[model samples]
Structures are given as C-alpha cells and as structure tokens.
Target: MYRYLEQRLAVRIMEFLRQRYPETALPAVVIEQPPKVALGDFAIPLFPFAKPLRSAPLKIAESIRSEIGSIEGIAEFRVAPPGYLNVRIDRAWLALAQALARDHVPKEEATSGKILVEHTSINPNKAAHIGHLRNAVLGDTFVRLLRYAGREVDVQNYIDNTGVQVADVVVGFTHLVKKSRPEIDVLAREPRFDYYCWDLYARVSQWYAQDKQNLQARSETLHAIEAGNNETAAVAETIASAVLRRHLETMERLDIEYDFLPRESEILHLHFWDAAFTKLKSAGVLTYENDGKNKGCWVMRRAGTGKSEGQQAEQALVQESGGERVLEEEDQKVIVRSNGTVGYVGKDIAYHMWKFGLLGQDFGYRKFYRYPNQHECWISAIEGEKHHPHFGGVAEVYNVIDARQSEAQSTVIEALRELGHNEAADHYTHFSYEMVALTPRCAAELGYALSEEDKTRPYVEVSGRKGFGVKADDLIDQLIVSAKSEVDSRHPELGDEERRSIARQIAVGALRYFMLKYTKQSVIAFDFKDALSFEGETGPYAQYAVVRANGIFNKAALDADEFARNVANKIPAEEFSQFLNGEATDEIWELWLSSSKTSYVVNQCIATTEPAYLAKHAFQLAQLFNAFYHRHPILSEPNEKRKQFLLATVAVVRRELTRTLAVMGITVPPVM
Candidate 1:
C-alpha cells in the first residue's frame, strides 16, 4: 500500500509539472524519505526543476506546492526553505486503509521470464565449511526475495563429480587405505562419512607432497574418472555422491534447498563439451596457438587485456610464418590443453549454454533426492526417466561463486558474447562474494593451532587442503549445544523435546542471520559471542520481539489476528488520526511507521542484490517496537480507543517481523 501510494503520487506530480511548464523538459520524478517523520513523510527537491523552469528553486517549490493539488493519500504539501516540497501523509485515511488492508502484501510485479540461481557448488570431495555456508545463505535468501516478488525461479547446485578434487579422494581410499568397493560402501553407510573423507583428502594431499611418484596416480585417477565406468570412476562416483548427500543435509538445516544437481560427470558422459567445442571453433571463439608458452593449446583472448604493440607486431610476423603464433601465454585463457583435455572453463561454457537454452542438447534427468517437504530434486544422468521435470533453459542465470573466480566467470561471459548469445551474456550474473574466515577468538575456541602472528591478526584463514577448517555440521552442533544450555536455563519447566526444538530454531536463526547481516563484499569472521546474543542486532533480538508481542495478547486474552481483522471497523478515522498526529504518541507512531516499510525494503533488497538492507530494517523495527513496548502499556491504559491503537501497532509489527524473518530463511518458533 505504501509503494502504491508513493508511485501514484509521483505520477501525479509529473503530470502537474508537465502542465505547468509546457516548453521545458521535465526530469524523472525522484522521491526520498525525510530524515525525520516529524518533518514530513517524504521530501522532493525542486532544485532540478529550477534550471528547467528558468526560475529560482524556492519559486519552483512554491509553484509545485500550489499546482500539485489534492493527490490521494496526501494530507498536505509544504514548501520548505532552500527549495523542497515536503509532503505529509493523510494519517486518518492511510491508517484506516492500511489497517483494512491488514498486512499490505503487494501484488506481484509483471515479470517476463524465469530466473535460474545456481549456488553452493561445493566440491564433492569433503565436508562443507563456513565459507560455503555464506554462499548458500546468500543465494537462498535471494531466491526467496525473487519468489516473494513473483518470479519463476529454479535453484541448482552444480556438482563437480569428475573433478581432480574427487579424483584425489578416490586415490585416498583406493591407494592409501587399500579399501575395496564393498568396504568403501560400508564406510559410506557410516555416519559422518563426509568428515572421514575430509581427513583422508588432507592425507592424500600430504602423501603427494612427500613423493613425486604419488602425483602420477592423481593424474591417472583423474583420467579414469573422466573416462567413466572403470574401478577408479566407480570409487570416485561413490565418494562424490555420498559427500553430495552430506552437503545437502548441512544446507537443509538452514532451510536451504535446491531444484537440481548438475554434475560435470554427466557433462562428460553426454559429450556436452564436444558439442560446445564444435561451435567455438566454427565461431573462432577459441584459436590454436602453435607457438610461445601456450604452444599447441586452444585459447581464448582474456577479457579487458590486450597484447602489447611489440607483441602484436611479432604475432603478425609469426602468423605469416606459422598459424596463430607469438601470443603471450598470460594474455590467453587455455580452453583445451595440448594433451586434449578440456579445461574447467570449457565445460562451464557448455553448462551455461544449456542454462540459456542456447545449446542444442539437454542433459538426461532423474529424481535423485527428495526433501522433507516432498519437493523432488533432479540430477543429470546418461539415461533417465521420460516424464521428468525440465531442468534448464532459463531466461536468466545467477551463479553464486566467490570473488576468486572472477577471471573464470568473465571468460564464460566472453564465450557467450563471442557465440552471439549477447542477451544471455547480459543477463548472466556472477553473484560474487568474499570468503568467510574465523576470528582469532573463534579460531582459538575451535582448538586450532594458531601462531602468535595469527593471534595478532583480525582473523585466521582456513585451508581445506590442510584439514584446518571447521566443518559446517560441527559448527552447527556446537551452536545448538550452546543455545540449548541457554534455553534450558531460561525455560527449565519445558519438556526436553520442546526445548531441543526451540534450541535448534534459535541456532539456525543465529547462523543464517549472521551470514546475512553483512554485504556480500564484506568478509565475515564468524564468532559465536556476537551471533548468539539476545540483546542487540541479532536474530534472537528480532525473535524475542515477536515473542514479547505474542505475550501481550496471551496476557490480555486477545487474538492478534482477530483484533487486526476488526481494527478497521472499531477505530474511527478521526480517532486513528488523533493518536498518530498527537505529539505525545511519538513513540507509537514511530513503530507504526517502521512497520510500513517492509515492502519498500524488500524492493530495495531485490534491486540492489543486497540482503543486508532487509536485515538492518528488521533490526531497526525491533528496536522501535521495543521502545514502544516500554513507553506504552496497552492493557493497563484506561482509554480503550488508545489501547486498541497500541494493540493494533503490536499486531502489525509481529506480522512484519514474522514475514521478514521468513524471507531471511529464519524461522520463529512457537516460543522463542
């Protein structure tokens, strides 16, 4: 309702300006909130109009104030000094209209196409870490925001089942542990098999470092796995599939799910790279470099970097003698090596082509996993079910990768443009974010061996190759234990099962909200003390606000939803306006005002691809409601009309907070 009124007012103001100045070119209508509600609900500067109208800004402000007459939902307009048009909302009409609307759920905007979000592409070799959690949470939150705005979305997790990481893990079980296929299968059935592999993966890295001969096995294992159906391939597939299941479980604890899992093994078996390679050659996207350091390689020009003048002249002379020569190796990205092995970017190009439906091929699909909610997740296969849901061919794509992969991501986009899929390239989004590390205090708490140098730094980086990182599940378990200790103390009378459930909710909320409260570009140093606190700017703070609001109704023996339903008919317009406009009721008015911006903040979040804005808005709303709760005691008040107004304010805040937390993937339990 707030968004509708704002847009409607902007359109009216534009019309008024056009009629008042027939010969002048008009500017876009810009509306911004005033610094304080006491000043005005919205402010529009007339400075831009001054030049166009050939008049002073103060004069234009007065003229717009006089000409823009009688806009709905606007009580009055004022011309402030220094050329500003401050508009006050019609409190009586707006309060009643918003109360009658109940929750102000906006209608979906007209979106034209489906959006594909691929995230949490964890290597299927070991357990997930805190860094991967940041990626999954960001992607999942964005998906929820898109769905709330009524977009068609498909969530995908690309599995690198045939990559070198998985190959090394296979070498571990087969060569180091001397485990047979049946023995490995038994291990997979055991609990925390991914954690076992995580340790073995580090051991494998160490073994290779000890002897140069062990590295040969890694290369051979990678080749066999890529070839498929050999013993090496079978072992790699089992480890990758089991580890993939573990990753899904870790993500599900935070309420994140996917629609599909596209594996690189399927890309190899189905010959997707072969199809993409043909088109690349035909379009000259990849050229053979027969000389220089990249000799006998197929390479694509790097984005935004050009050859030096001397190198270009040398390349021209060399090309006359030999085809495609004299290019700097660093200036080109190798797509196919001299040994006829396709690079990671080569396969990624094909995968993205399939995403935009530009490839003339499709992956065979089968239902591989199902969630508790009964939503089936599909996986790529060589042969599969005939009646399966279609997986790819989306109009837009967002790949949630870390900032370290910027070069590879840019190469994929360049390939798309080179192949004439300009629109797909334009629509493609590399949802890049920085990595997550552990704070010095957190690292010490994890029992990690931090040197004195590390202790002096703000954070300690973790490496999977060295088995130094905290596993995602381990961190989640520790958080639950911590939360359970707090919950047991606060609610000792509650049953064991109920307390455990509440602790899980609080733990998950703390983890997800902590990951979301910062911008994508900000690197978070995870710490428990900051995330678990219930007092300020934490998930528990917001959840506690909702619980307190619920307690108000529980004590008063009133139904919040019922009171909200009857509020429009019960409170007269004059009375509603009087309570809001009264100077004495400033605190309650602030709460009401904060609750109205949920939709506005959501729109801002989607436009900016920044979930931190919405997180901050939720925190601010909780702060305002807490202030209101202390200032006004609704049940103890003598004036019934004023009590009803305060009750309605609580109702709206509860609804908005509930909705905001839901979108953030944070759940509010029955009793927080």
Candidate 2:
C-alpha cells in the first residue's frame, strides 16, 4: 500500500535534484521501509548520492521535503537527524488498499511461466526421514510461492535407480534372502517395502564387512545390472521398480506431487552421456592420459579451483574408501575410466547438459502414472519410446543434493560454461542442505546400544548402510495418531471418516511446518518427542489462527462482499484518509502495511534456501491477526461501518495467510 507513497516521494526528490543541481546526472532512487513501524513507514537515505549532489545529505533531504510540498496520502514528512527522509502513509489508504488488493491486484503480477523445482531426490532405498522432509517441504513451498507470485512451476523428483544404494537392496534380495524375482515382488507390495529394504540393505553392508571377498558379489551384480543383459539385472529391476513405486506412494501421502520422474537408467540407455562425450571430444574439452596413476583413461583435468579449495574434497575420498581421484589432464574431468566405464559424476554431467538443451538430444517421454485429475505423470525413458509431453525446457534447474557433492556440481557448472552457455550454468543452483541426525534418546528408543564414541557424537548420523534412520511411513502414521487426539479434543462430534480427513490435513501441516521451522543450516537431530508436539511454535498454531479468523467471518452473519459494499455506501463520505490526519492510525492499516512485505520474504527464502525465514514471517502474521482479533469485534459492533471495516480486514488477513502457508506446503485446515 505504501509502495506508491515511496515512489511518489522519490519522484519529488529527483525533481528537486534536477532543479537544484541541474548539471548532475540523476542516480537510481531506492526507498526502504524503516526498521520499526514508529520510525515512519518509509525512509530514503541520501548519503549514497550525496557526493554527486555536491551538498550535505541532510540539507538535500530537507530541501527535497520543503520543495516537494504536500503529496497525496502522505500523512506526515520529516528529515531524520542523520539525513534520511521519513514519510508516513495515510492510514486510511492502507485500509482501503488492503481491501482492494484482494480484488484489484494487477493481472500481470498475478500470473506468469512455470519454474521447474527438483528437490528431495532421495535414493529410493530406505525410508523418507526428517532430512528428506526438509528438502521436500522447502521445495514444495518454493513451488507454491512462485505460483502465488504468478509464475508457472513444475515439480520434479529424480530417481537414482542404478545407484549403489539400490544395488545394495538388490544384493540383499539375491544373496541374503535367496529370493527370486516373483517372491521379491510380493514382498515389495507390503506396506513396509521401503522399511523392509532399509533393514535388508543395511544387513548386506555388514555382510560385506565380515568378509572382504564377499564384496565381489556386489561388484558382479552392479556390473551385470549396468550391462543390462542378464537375470541379475532383471531381478534388480523388479526390486528397484517396486521399491521406487512404494517411495512414490509415500510421497503422495505427504501431499507431494511431481511433473516428471526421470530415472538414471533411462539417461544411460538414451545415451545422453554418449552425446555429451562426443561434444566434449570435438570441443577438445576432454583428453586421455596413458602415463599416469589412471593410465589409459579418457580423462579431463580437475576443473581449476582456488589454491585452498579441493583439499577437503581430496581428503574426504581418501578417508572413506582409499579410492583415488585421477585428474583428466588439467582442469577437466574424466568422462570414462581407464579400465573402460563411466564415472558416477560423468552420467550426472550428461544429465545436466541434457537439461540445458546443450546435448542437442532429448529423452523419449512416456505417461507413467495416472493422476486423480487425469493429468499424465510423465517419465523420461528409452525402452518405452512413446510420445508424451515435452520433458526438458526448464527455465531453472535445482539439484537438491548434499554439500558433499559440491565438487561434482561444480564440474557440471564448468561444463556448461565451457559450452558457452553461461546462463545455464548460472541458473543451476546446487540447493544443498545439511543432513539430519538421530538424537541420542531417539537412537536409544530404536534399541541401538551406544559406544562411548557414539555417546560423545553431537548427533547420531543417519547411515544408509546401517539403516539407522526414521522411515517416512513410520513418521506419517505417528503424525496421524498425534493429530487425532487434538482433533477429537476440539470437535468430538465429527464422524470418524471426517475426523480422519481433518487429521491428515493437520498431520501434513504439522510435519511440513516443523521440518521448515529451523534454519536450513541447523542440523536436525530427528527427535520423535519434539516432532510429535502440536502445541507452541508449530504448524498447528498457524492453522489454528487461520481457522479462528474464518470462524469469526462465518459467524459474523455478513459476507465479505456485503461488508465491503456497506462500508463504501453508508460510511461518512469525507474519504477516511482526510481524517486520519497527521498522527492517527488504524489497526487494519498496520495489517496492510505488514502484509505487503511478502514478496521480499519469498525472495529471501529463495536466495538463502532457508524456509525458516518464511516460517518466522508466518508466525509474525499469526501474531498480528491474534492481537487484532482480541481488540476488535465484527458482528457484535453496533457501529455498522466500523463492523464492516473489521470484516474486510479479517478477509485480507485470511487470504494472505492462506497464500503464505500454501507457499510452504502447509495447508491450513478450515477447522482445527
């Protein structure tokens, strides 16, 4: 509401500058809302352009204020002690704009092209734990915010079907259980497929440790599966495809949806890497070395880095498995290894190249899943070469990988830059976040005995190899149970089916918000007791606040439409701004002023990849609504015009809060 007030004031200032210092070139005008509401609604600091003005900043501010004289909707104006122009907006304009914003927002700013957000691309080997929740919640929220800002967005979840984690589950089926493909398929249909594989995969990891020679079986299975020509690959595919399907169902339970499910196997078969290799070779971007530690390898040098960089990267690989990293030549990466095979990073680079349309090749897409709305859920592929919707033209690509993979992501960026597509490289953001850990008590609750080393650790690390983590299905069941108690306490008359639906809504709200409440940099300790709580500083509170607002409006006996019309037709015709004068304010005005800061909040969250910023904003809005609700009455107020204004104000709060929570994938239940 005050944005125009600032704009008008800035124009006046520039005009003053033109008249006072005619020879000076005008600079860009930047107006900012002050840190506190009482400090005036907006401020302009002139020190930044003072040198060019050839006058003191304080004098310039005063001169501009005096020369510009009075402007519309500016209640008051003054120059601060430090030479900032402070301007307060007319309180009634805020109330009017807040009411108008809902019905009269510019159409161009309300809808725009979709953004492709790929997040929570977790391996389909185990349960979706808190770490996975953080990625999905943030990604889902990002999609909502973009859509709210009028941008089109397509969500994606990338499945790494041929990765080591999936391979371990395959090993568990073949070597440990000695189960055939049909038996494995039956086992996979159980509700606990991800859970079952979680334990089995961990056991397989331990089995390999017992005897070094046992590792050969895993290597054999991996090779056979990659070769795509044997029974081992068939069995692996059955288990992988089955378990991955289960993963999708779990995500659906969390209300997460996707536009595409791109599989790594499809990328390999599509030979995206083959095209990428040809381009690199033709461009002389990759070279081969025969007289080094990695002899006979088609290689590229380690991409150039600052002197202090790549040290932790070099140390981490050495510390883990003593596996060596061989530079391709100088500032390049090996597309294929010496013994004849592609590196994991090589396939990923190819995928990135293809995403940017740099590969000059595309995947054959096929409709895989039938959505409830009958929309096609597309999957990228090679075998099922059917025509589906377009798979790639992404305006932006986000890979929700761990920070540990920064080196590989950098290689992808370097490849794009070398290909002369700087925008593609620049647009690719490695949306990295820290891992989740199990609290000591939670780890103990899971029946794991701790060594002194474990006791001294900051948090119990989630080890895929050990299956030491919370399962997504397990958490969802618990959330539903937790939510039911609250629902039953509040509305005992609700039918069982109706209550269950409401409880699930509450469950999603509680879980998504909790996952996003903490700053992304803060490591989660996967505490069950803390996660289960619905009271204080949780999603339920935010939902409860909105629910209360809606209840007030519903019980007020006047529709938002009637209330707005009544206020306009029957209220005093002096134009409320004329009476708000120099010092008076309306609470509705404060709500409008505060409510308008959402775009900045959304951008900050996007730039920082931290949902906590949004979480804080949501909390603040909830607080504002609550305080406003206590002091103001709608239907009970005998003054008809005042009553109508309150109703309209509540309506604005309700809309913005809904949009804000939706941006974070937190659905506000109508009843709580």
Best by lDDT: 1
411-469: candidate 2 lDDT, tens digit per residue? 77877777677888888888777777898888989888888888788798877778777
At residue 15, what lDDT does model 1 achieve?
A: 89
TM-score of 2: 0.89
What is the TM-score (0 to 1) of candidate 1? 0.94
Give the Cα RMSD of candidate 2.
4.7
Q: Top model by TM-score, which number?
A: 1
lDDT for each residue of candidate 1 in 1-672, tens digit (9 for 90 to 100): 677778888988898888877888889888988888877788888888877788898888788788777887798898887888898888777777666654444455655689999999999999999899889999999999888777899999999999889988999998999899999999987779999999999999999999999999999999999988788898888889999999999999989999999999889889999999999999999999777787888999887565679977877887787755334555789999988899999999999999999888998899988999999999998998898988788998998999889889999999999999999999999898889988999888878888899999988777888887778998789879988998999899999999999999988888888888999898887786776565678888888888899999999999987877788888888888988886676666667666777788888888888889889988988888888888778899999888888888888788788889999998887676
For all the candidates, what are their Cα RMSDs to the real structure?
A: 2.9, 4.7
**What stretches of model 2 exceed 4 Å from their correct place?**
1-30, 50-55, 69-74, 102-114, 303-333, 560-588, 607-610
Clashing pairs in 1: none
